[model samples]
Target: MKAPTNRRRAIAKALTALLPLAPYADMEKIRAEAGRAHLHNLPPTIAVWLAIIAHIRHAHTDYEKLLADGYDRDSARFFVIEQTNIVLTRWRATRFLDADDESE
Candidate 1:
C-alpha cells in the first residue's frame, strides 16, 4: 500500500483534533454539501483543510490572505469560505438535531 501523503497526514491530524469538539461530525456529509455548493471539483482533502482552518481561525481568516500567499484567488475564496460555510451549516444542523434528540 502506498504511504499517506503529507497533506493527508495533516488532514488526519486536524480531524483528530476536531473530532473531540464535534464528535458527531460527518466528513461525507461535509463533502457532499461542499459539492452541492459548486466545489465539486475541489479535492476533498483541500476542502477539509479549508474547513478546519476556517474553524480554527474563525473570523480572522481572510481569503485575500490566501491569494496574497499565492493560492488561486477565486478558488481559494470559494473553498476556504464559501465551501466551508456549506459544511459548517450542515454541521450546525446536525448538532441541533443531536441536541433535540438528547432533550427528548
Candidate 2:
C-alpha cells in the first residue's frame, strides 16, 4: 500500500512531538484507538492533530477576547505568559531540529 500523505505524516510528527514522553502518554495507542471510530478505515493521527489545533485555536480566540475586554490583569497575564511559552517551545522545537533529527 502507498504511504500516507504529507499532511498526515506532518500531523503524526507534530502530535508525537507535542505530547510528553510520560508513561501514560502513548500517542500511538491513542492513534490506534482513534482509528476504531470507523471500521476498516480511520482518520490518521494527523487528522486528530488537526482537530487538536482547531481546539487550541478556539482557546486562543477566547483568551484574546478576554484580554481585549480588560479582564483581570492577573488572568490576562497568565494566559499570555502560557501562550508565549507554547509559541517559543514550538518555534525552538521545529526551528533548530538537526538535519539528522529530521527523520520524524
Candidate number achieving the greatest TM-score relative to the actual structure: 2
TM-score of 1: 0.27
Q: How do the residues 1-104 of candidate 1 rate in per-residue lDDT, one tens digit apiece?
A: 22236444545554544433343445433333333334334564545544544442333346656777787745554545544444445444221112122211
Error of 1 at 15 (Å): 4.9
Please state the error at residue 95 of candidate 1 in Å.
25
Show how many residue pairs clash in every candidate, following the order shown: 0, 0
What's the C-alpha lDDT at position 85 in model 1?
A: 46
Which residues of candidate 2, in runs, are more than 4 Å off? Answer: 1-4, 20-57, 60-62, 68-79, 83-104
Worst 10 contiguous positions by lDDT, candidate 2: 95-104
**Given candidate 2, what's the lDDT at residue 45?**
50
Q: What TM-score would every model get versus the actual structure?
A: 0.27, 0.28
